[model samples]
Target chain A: MRLKLLGLAAAVALLAACSSDQDAAGTGSVTGATSATAPTTNAGAVRPGTRQDFEVNVGDRVFFGFDQYDLSPEARSTLDRQAQWLNQYRAVTIQVEGHADERGTREYNLALGERRANAVKNYLVARGVDPNRVGVISYGKERPAVLGSNEAAWAQNRRGVTVVQ
Target chain B: MTMSAFMTRCDRLARLAVLALAVLVAGAAAARAELRVDITRGTVQPMPIAITDLLGQGQSEGQIGRDISAVVSADLERSGLFKPIDKRAFIQDLVSLQQQPRFADWQVLRAQALVSGTVEPQPDGLVRVAFRLWDVAAQQHLTGFAYRIEPKAWRRVAHKIADQIYERITGEKGYFDSRVVYIAESGPANQRVKRLAVMDQDGENNQFLTDGRSLVLTPRYSPTTEEITYLSFFNNRPRVYLFNLETGRQEVLGDFPGMTFAPRFSPDGNRVLMSMAANGNTEIYAMDLRTRRTQQLTNHPAIDTAPSFSDDGSRIVFESDRGGTQQLYVMGADGSDVKRITFGQGRYANPVWSPRGDLIAFTRLYQGRFYIGVIRPDGTGERLITEAYHVEGPTWAPNGRVLMYFKETPSSDGRSRRARLYSIDLTGQNEREVVTPMDASDPAWSPLIP
Candidate 1:
């Protein structure tokens, strides 16, 4: 019963956080919002949302399979939302960071990470984000989000994160 | 003439002949006084050697003298070629630089060779070190040398003395008088902070070159200069940076539109080879330092990186996945005759050509383990030197006698992974850990400094 109460509290807190995010977007810039093709319904603001908002609402990251850079359907869906959020904030520029698991040579993983980041950038550009606004950087296996050598940690580490600049 | 006169003349001729013979024998003995030991094969058991504490002259007894001797002893010990005998077994104590060692006593202790030296403080605030090598079996002096240097460089002086002895005995160049530049890592597994560090080959005089605010990797030393080319992640943009040790200056290699990494200096240190990615395709590029002009070496759609030049700078070996899985390839300096050099079941990467131009060291991964190996340029006589759970980034010592690489042990609890540096001889023997203050990797040994 205590676990259920805690779950309810967490849901309420999440809803409150999302509503506050929408309120901030609504009061932000209305001019940039007017210029975008489809402004977010809750916010008539044109300014780009915070990186935290993009991560929480639009999904800031996508994962790839082992030694592979091709995007999956789930990854494509995440990129689509990222594109919509990027389009909503016309004035903001973003940098895509590609990372890899610690199973390969440092130099080779560096190249693999580059391919992964560029794959995301290409997908987002096809989904209507400007190519000039999106830059890519690869950290290789140096900055792993997860630390373990297990499959779970490796899967989480092989990801691309988009950050607003 | 009478018979008695004839007998007297014959006796006088005999005396003259004896005198001539004696003079010739004396001259030959003088010429052969300097003993020599021919080392035709590496010893299974290290030859026993005794290095006495170097006596200090006109100074505080044996302070610096003992320190230098300890460094020299440690260097010879780490080489796995010499076993320093205990001083307690010595029958005769070292007293003065001018006195000759009682070779019979060293022979009694079963020492094959003896090293004795003296340190004297000079009037110009420098220390003069003089050492002599003795062959116990021959009971003769083999070689000796003297040098005057600042007291602060005592360790280098010791290394120099050790190198001289090593070369004289082994008939090969010694790598003691060298430095290594590597990436020093610290902190938790997830948030590792790596910095560029330089130190003596035996893990002394360590100094960090970078502040760890930016991540650094794969520092390659120039064969002819005190400069290194490494990859850095400053401002979240990964680029190749060239750092000069003497000048304490750092600069980005080129103004690329995208990321540039995996850098190495040409054999002559005139150019740098690196990989640059654009529009998701990574290719090898070389830049001439004198003209500041860049040239693309590989124009393939597949990734071609980690380009290491041969000693003559005529060819390069690199890793690529153009044929499906990662494999090594050799090509001319002009990017012609690109032939795959690895065709085994596993993937190979980071092919570094030996300074002797005979073998290329590389990292191999197969069946969930990583290996450090060497192969001929023609992909013949492939030999795996060492294996670990995860090993990569093999760099050759200046003499090409040893290869240094990094090994990582995975954390079972997912939070405390450990990495360390290790080295092995080219013959796959004498595998030893190069202890660092913290986790270290990507070691690049500098050529013997002038």
Candidate 2:
């Protein structure tokens, strides 16, 4: 009941915040959700009725290749599941963060990351997810999922992750 | 040349260089290098110099003299144009040199040039500085200057003395009296905290402008003022902001509905050129700094960013993918006569126009490696200056004779990455690292301080 109330408050805030203003208070649930979910990296856990439910069961992130924004077959399969889960949670809107590896220049990587995020948005919208329910941002090479300079880290860093608000 | 070779073969060309120096200091001044490098011959050699401690009356003044002279030596040494002869080999004492520098004594140490100065502390709590630059080989006094400044400005005084020597010897405006602002990076790769940092061009007097509360990137110094314009992720909305160093106040450049980034200042410092990304389309925009009015320079469907202005602010060179790949394009300052400038063998990005208006520096990604290259504005005389696993952000010294960029080096296991700053000349030689306390990137060299 408490989480439901919080979700309702966030949904109201999101609607009142509208499409343009980047109000910091709009993501009340997201700020707490990240800290609670950061420690739960288990892949097999699939509990329902919580924010981690979407992250664990729906798989919030899709990876991309180096300097390549075109979705692969595996990424498409993941987005398909994400779109369904997002549609189910009517009050839960999401902000998709697109990231890139550190190999490219900062400005160019930003543009590349935007293309990736926009691609994911276009894919989810095509799958019948409401366009207004989804927001997009490109962190570029600033935020990395893993801390390494190797191919493994680079592969994980170049990704589009959906954050539930 | 390396240090050992510089010591052994230093005297061979001293006689021939005297005539060249005379012609350079007389008629070809301001457009020529008085140091060892001869651009026409494509040869690089650091001129040998002997720096002596400044004579002083009191103990504190003597301490200041030593500190000031050390800074001057370090400045010349870092330029890769002057090889300061070791002090252990000096035969002339400060007492004798203050009266009359014994040229044969310095010549025995293979010093082609000599610098001597003095420091005087005033009763009013101010300090006075006077310096002399002498051509040791020709036994002639080249330049001398005196300055009176507060004691807190000793580093600046030292830099000014170095600038006088550099200008008199090289026949070009000295870059010593300048500051460099860059991004000071820390934390892990995923959660990096970037702050704005500034220091002297020779890497002294370091200060952090921001406290690392928000992420800042690509800080550019105003060519005409003590202000910087950069992109900030404040409030989770990427926007361009102008920060005044004097007032410690930051103002958003404009209230664009989308991200405003890749910012640079015009040569006149009256406007800022940046990229505004709206929807899925990115284009270049120039905003009047005072009026906050913006004029879109490119109306392309593809990504267009990293816009830089020519010295006169009449033309802008930026990178765009309208040609199906990232390449540099030159357009008029009014967004007219758009023409591509780079036709190289790789994807070109991060195009920065040289301050002299003769060249454009960019990062070329080919296959997997990155190269920092310079190309003429007219799409000719393209040359690669340096290469690395990851190198980007080329900024020019105010004189336009040298360039500074950052290079990221991977750790042995390839799990961690370290980014550091480096400087290189237009001749593709004298590549030196500009050290910082922490990981650094996106360096912006300020104009010579007023």
Candidate 3:
């Protein structure tokens, strides 16, 4: 009880010190409050159809290999889970954003990203998901999730991310 | 040269002589065309040139005169064909040169070409400029011109004078009076703000077309230079958009079912050739601007992008993966007689046909490095001009004598990368970085402004 009160006091003091700087503390306090009353808020906070729930529970993205649109067994399994989750929510439509690593040229990378996205969409349709409920976009190496030029960064960058609105 | 072409040039010279006869009488040897610049070879010894300041009688006049003279000198020196000598080495002033050019004074400094001019402030808020080009070694007058323009148009007037000098000496058109459209980028790598921008070829008068609210890419100028076509991700849908400079009217090119990008103008500027991705396949298409009709050029399942038309509009050169790897191919404008043109070791893409129609510029990616290269139309005489960690999107000057491309260099242990624009001639020498306000890419050079 005493620690929770101190944490709240610190967050309030942080807000008063600098409102702009409290962006970091804002999230820290939320996490602290949730942990304090873990049992009640944990179940109530799980909005099943929310983007956070979809990302945490349903796996909203899959990875790809270097210069290849062919999905690996692991990526296929992730898409399988995605299809199952998406089928449960019939009213939701998702856009699959196809991305490529920065090792290639712009125009060609765009094509490669398109191929990867269609590969994901085809997998989902084959797994009993409605084709019309899904759309795809190829970012073509324009946006990267990571900011380094190494292999680890490239591996994370080559991906197909699903978003729900 | 053909007999008709030679005769046509002779007729032009005759006309010039007739027009300039009022200023002064021409000697017999003055009519002979000499001091030619051979641009065919890969290396050249720059011809020494002497550019005298345009004598202005007043303060503002002299300032404009000096500015105009400096611009002309910079243009000539940047072409890598002439070396403008230092002004401190001058023995004869513009007054003396206008009165009587002493060939011995210029010859002593090894200046084969000498330029002398004057700026006269007109009565009605205009500037009257007259200039002369002399061949010092031959001791003969080459050419001269006079113009009346507003003081605000001094930069353009300088470029025009340089164009005249270049045309008289090299027998080709000049690309100084031109503009380039590019994508200016800022912010982090993941959340970048790419805006469409246009600037003078010398990196002046820059203005942003888009407010950087939406992501834009790959802007290309039409032949008339009055319109630009580019790809924009507006409202989360990528489409091709056209902006008219004169009217400030913007519109989508056409309603396509998929993403449309890499749109380039044909020789006549009536149609835009671009690539569209749909149904898990990418193909090339041409849309006629007037009728709102699109013609699918490539029907292959493989990727076909970066289509550029030839100077005569009879053929096109593009990159296709139909041959298992990204290679360049030539096809008729109607999508017939498709022939593979590149057999090099690397994957070649971004093929732009030269304005002269003699060579095609392309980007080749091999072993993790990119190269800007040129090859013949018949798939012969391949030459790699510049290489870097990442360089692509080569655009041609109006004269086809120089190429501008974007190069991305890594800084600080390959964590952050920066893209900058660069230009290099066919000779592979005199490579220069074009300065910009921010990181830039996807440079598209426009034809000389009409």
DockQ of each: 0.32, 0.35, 0.32
Off by over 4 Å in 1: A1-48, B1-43, B59-61, B96-98
User: Regarding TM-score, does 1 or 2 come out ahead?
Assistant: 2
Q: What stretches of model 2 exceed 4 Å from their correct place?
A: A1-49, B1-41
For candidate 1, write residues B1-450 as lDDT tens digits: 222221222221111111111111123234243433333343346778999888887555368788888988999888877889988887886784248777778888898888988888778666777777777887666666777665666777788789877876766788897878999999865467899998889998788889998888999988754688999888767899998765678999889998899999998889999999988899999999999899998999999999999999999999999999899999999888999989998899999999989999999999889999999999999989899889999988888888889998877775567789888878777889999999999999988855
Model 3: DockQ vs. true structure:
0.32
The residue-level lDDT of candidate 1 at B285 comes to 92
- For residue A133, give model 1's deviation from the true position in Å: 1.5
lDDT of each: 0.79, 0.78, 0.81
**Selected candidate, larger lDDT, 1 vs 2:** 1
Q: Which stretches of candidate 3 lie over 4 Å from their true place?
A: A1-44, B1-32
TM match of model 2 to true structure = 0.86
Instruction: Give me the candidate number with maximum lDDT.
Output: 3
lDDT of 2 at A40: 44
TM-score of 1: 0.85
Model 2 residue B69 lDDT score: 88
